[model samples]
Target: MDRVRLLVLLTVFVDILGLGVVIPVLPFYVERFSNSPQAVTTLIAVYAAASFLSAPLIGVLSDKYGRRPALIGSILSTSLGWFIFASGKSLLVLYVGRIIDGLAAGNLPVAQAAITDTVKDEKERGQVLGYVGAIFGIGFIIGPAIGGALGHLSVTLPFWFVGALAAVNAVLAYFFLPETRKQQEAHTHPISLNPFSPMKRAIQQKDMCSNYLAWGMFGLAVASTQSVYALFLNVAFGWEEFMVGLLFMATGIVLAVNQVFAMRNFWLKKFTEPKLELWMTAAFAFGYVLIGVASFPLFIVGAILTTFGQSVLRVVMNSQMIAKSNPTRRGEVMGISASIVSLTAAIAPLFAGWLFDLRPSLPFFAAAVFLGIGFFILYSAQKTLPTTLDPRQPVVSEI
Candidate 1:
């Protein structure tokens, strides 16, 4: 592996591993503050909302300044946020910590931008990003198990662990990850502070709006499913913690597999961005229906396919987000685009939780219906948007 890639990937791993440590314990921590399960969901919503608000700002800042400082600051912000979360005794402190973390949420997007800075070819971007994502996914797999095991000792332990890890990430990023943005080249453009400027372009241009809305709707389609899917599994099978962990690890497995091989071997080469998108539309429609009605074995199968299908689709969507944007405006464009998706993510879980309470199957079925509609929106956009491919390699047949 490339040394710089290793640095960036290791930094990401350390950062996410801390988050993993909290996965099994976060709900329990929130419960200590309130009797309502909605409280846990609300906490997550608060974080997502904060991220949605901060991403554009971070994007704008990165565009003016450079990636290194932005990344270093981002890590410090997360470190402090987690510290507050670990130390806090009340809901107010938790919310404050989440807001800080939201600001730092720019890390992933900005890092991707950084990767784009270093990665010259398009084909390599997918596989490289997949490796980046795989590291984070492995963190998710390893984090919870470690966190859950640690939580047996103290809920606060994992938070401190995450906070410390984030601090370590800051140091690693400082020493290791290079500033790849052509800063001297970037300095030629007039800097922007008006956060709405990026959105204004989308407003003025119909194609930009089309791409933005397609991504937004796709985000919304999956939102309710995440919040309710665990509940669905629980109601359907009375799954215990280990079983749920097993299910989560299953998603991670597919994610890892796709990152390592499928993305490069089949997905990226076979499907153009538009074609892969269309397949995603079809696969999700079928997958959700399967999730809604299938028995345990079938449910597992659907969930895996959903992961594979979405992973395939998202690889393209993210690359397109970068490729389509004016390079100067990339940070702002991606941040805001992510915000649209994050907005849905913020709302999806709450709705899913509520729907799950009413009927376990209801959320999956509802999401399936919405996904079908979302697919139509994507298809409409696909027809008009020319196939945008990576710059690195020859295009392959549609799988």
Candidate 2:
């Protein structure tokens, strides 16, 4: 494993450590300030909007400047965002904090670019990626429990605590994180903020568009679930903040277990490439449908199943995206994928929030429908994928 990859993975996990801790608490905290359910939802929406709008630009920056500095800047910005969020005495400040987080949302993608940049062999890519997933699961497990305990102090404490942790993470990265971008030797254009350029480059290539479709569908499903789960738990079971922590912690444990012990080889063997995506589509569709109809017991059941399904989908989708992309254009392809997914994530909360208001079941039901659509797209498009689990240089095109 590249030492740089390990650093970036640690950086990602550390950053997520703060996020998982705060996420379970965010909606409830918002509700306390403004009873407007829509307003609370919009709080999420604003962050997503910032992420969606900026991801492409950020990716290009990584392309031009390099992944390490871009990631470093994003981490520093994230630390600042948490500080603003923790100090906020009003909803406006909350909005400001989220905006800051959203603007720096390219951290994860840039991290991915670093991984891609450092690792040339596909098999090692999967292994390194699996390690990253395991680290993320580690964050998920500890973050919420810590947040729940600190939350007893005050709702705002976790945000500040996370801010402190993120600052620690930034320092760690500055000292240790390595640069992976190799553009210094290549023929490449300087990154620009010109709005139409990235999109034009991304779509101009045929294979790039195909892979991006798979990438987009995965994001839509994943985002819908992440956005609405808090409201669903609050409304359906009247879960307290601590209880929400337990559920997230539970998911994190499961995810961690699979990524470490079971998922990598299991998915690699059982659901290879495009074929695996179909299974993922079905699994995701089934899980969300169950969530829509579940009572208290069933909600738990649905959560467990959906987590399993999503883990598989995420691994397969990401692996294929890397494999399918041509080496010359990998960063561009990855950037397009991230931007589309971020856009989906940004819009999803607004839709899920409104749906949550209409009916507690509305978000879940919509999740199923949207995933069903994504699944169908994957199912139909399966032929485009390489047949085996082995990685190859990707070639995507409109068919």
Candidate 3:
């Protein structure tokens, strides 16, 4: 890998690592202010809501101003958000922190755009993205462990640690990260501050619409499962908190291994992106159904299957979206994708919580159904979508 690609990867890794360190401990911190589990869940939604509102705007800014400035601003915002969260004296303060973090959540898309700017080859892009996915998985796995351990000292300690990490990362990036987007004359247009405008424009294209719908469904499924998975385990198997964390760690390890080693070394060689997506959808559907059955051994199997499926699918879909988009518009397109997923994530958890109250297994079944719908959408659009993984060919929109 070249220096630019490696720097982009490092930026993504550090950003995700900060997120990982905070998430596991967040709910516990929130409970100190409010006893309601719903309140904690609401905090998650608030962050997603802010991200949904700010993502497209961030993308537009990156396009107009340059990725380097946008990235630096985002990192600074994240550091500030974590600092506020750590120092919070009230629930309102916590909410404010989350909103700040969400509004600055452009790091992933900006980093991805930076990678696109650097790597021109489609296959090489996919491989590098697989590594990014692996970094994300590893960060999540290690982050929770760090948070859990730190919580023994103080619930807010992890937040403080992550805040410092983000601040340090921002300094490093400001010094080392160069502008990847070439300086060019700005295109004249009325820049819409409305967050939904970019998303609307992206989805108006026929091919992009199908892809977005499929991606949205997939996000919904994952969000719903995440909302209730720990509770489901406790209800069904009487597992304790440590067991739950262990399970998550195991799944993350599997996912990271699959993306970094399996996909990079084997899967990309054997299957096109579309075919890989189909197979992953099938795996997701099967895994969700198995999880709903609520047997211990089957649950383990389901965890492994779902983790592998979802991990590979995420990298594959991201690669496809980047490839299908016009090179110049990659940031805008990715921002739209991020915004839609955030919207779904904000909504899915509330719906899943309600369904879980109705039936412990309902959320799992619903996740399967969502994935099934996603599968059909992809299947129907297969002919219209690009058959090969190469981005150099005319994309589906051009057809």
Candidate 4:
């Protein structure tokens, strides 16, 4: 890989590492303040809610100022958030930490835009993104194991460690990460900070609205399933902290292998992007259904299917979105995409948590239903969507 690609991958690895370390242990940590699993999911939702509001603004900032500064500043904010979370003594303090982190959640979109800036070849772009996904899988594999072991010692230990890593990452980016956005074309039309602005612009484009809708529905399904997964395992299988970590590790392995070995090399060559997306959505729906009714052995099968399906779907969808965007506005387009996903992230956990309180299986059932609807939308819209970009024109025409 090239130097810029490697740095972007490292940045993503460090960011996702913090998430992997925290997610498995967050429920237990929050239980120190509140006994309800619903409260834990609410904490997760609060972070996404903040991100939902901030992501487009951050994207606009990166477009106006530059990607490197945006990345470094966001990383610094994450470190501060982790520090706050580690030191907090009250539930409100925990919310404060998540809010801080959420406001800086534009790091991922900026990093993705940087990659889009450097890579011009559409096929190679998809392959490189798979590498990014592979890094995410590797981070999850290592981070959760370490976090689980540390959690056995003290719940706060993993947070301190992750905070320290984020600080170091910020310093490294300051010294080594180069600016990729061209200076001459840096300024664009004035960007609105309103969270709904990106969505409104997206909706005005007839060709793109259905794609965004499908992507948002996919986000909702995945977020809802994730919100209740650990709790479900605890209730149904009586798994401990370490076992939960192991299960996530296994899912990560499946994800990494599919991205690196299958999607990057074979599948992208074999299938059209829209066709792959449609199949993956169906796979996710089936996997969720299986998980909803699963016993121990069947649960493993369902988990593998779900991980593989989502992993492929994410890479394909992201590749298509980037390809369909004007090169100059890649950052803005990605920010809008993140905003759509974050909006779902904000809402799904609250809904899932409420359903979980009613019945453990209800969240998974809801996820399957959502994915099925997303699949239908994508399938219906496949004929109008272009798989390749016309470099001279914007990918979608505004109405």
lDDT by residue (1-399, candidate 1, tens digit) is 677777777777787778767765676677678855567667777888877767776766776787778878888889999899989899899989988888667887777776666666667777677776676568767876777677777878888888888888899888878876676535345545665565565566555666677677677767767655544565688864456656666676777777778778877788766777777867876787788885877787778778876777666777766666656666666677767777777987687667766777877787777767767877777776667754333232111
Q: All candidates' lDDT scores?
A: 0.72, 0.74, 0.80, 0.83
What is candidate 4's lDDT per residue for 1-399, written digit by digit as tens? 789888888888998888888878888888899988788888888888888877777877887888999899989999999999999899999999989998888888889888777775766878887887787788888888988998999999989989999999999999989898887647477777677776677777677777788889899999898888889999889987899999888878877888789876787889877788899899998888888885887787788889988888888787777777666566777788888888898899998999999988889989999999999999888876675654234677532
Q: Tens-digit lDDT track for model 2 on 138-219?
A: 8889999998888878988999999898889888888888778775523166666774576777777665455567667667
Candidate 4 structure, TM-score to reference: 0.96
User: Over 4 Å off in model 2, which ranges?
Assistant: 183-187, 388-392, 396-399
Measured against the true structure, the TM-scores of the candidates, in listed sequence, are 0.90, 0.92, 0.93, 0.96
Ranking by lDDT: 4, 3, 2, 1
Off by over 4 Å in 4: 390-393, 397-399
- Inter-residue clash pairs, candidate 3: none
| 183-265: candidate 3 lDDT, tens digit per residue | 55222346688887887777567767777888998988988877667667878998644556566667768878887889878
- Measured by TM-score, the strongest candidate is 4
Order of candidate numbers by TM-score, starting with the best? 4, 3, 2, 1
For candidate 2, give the lDDT. 0.74
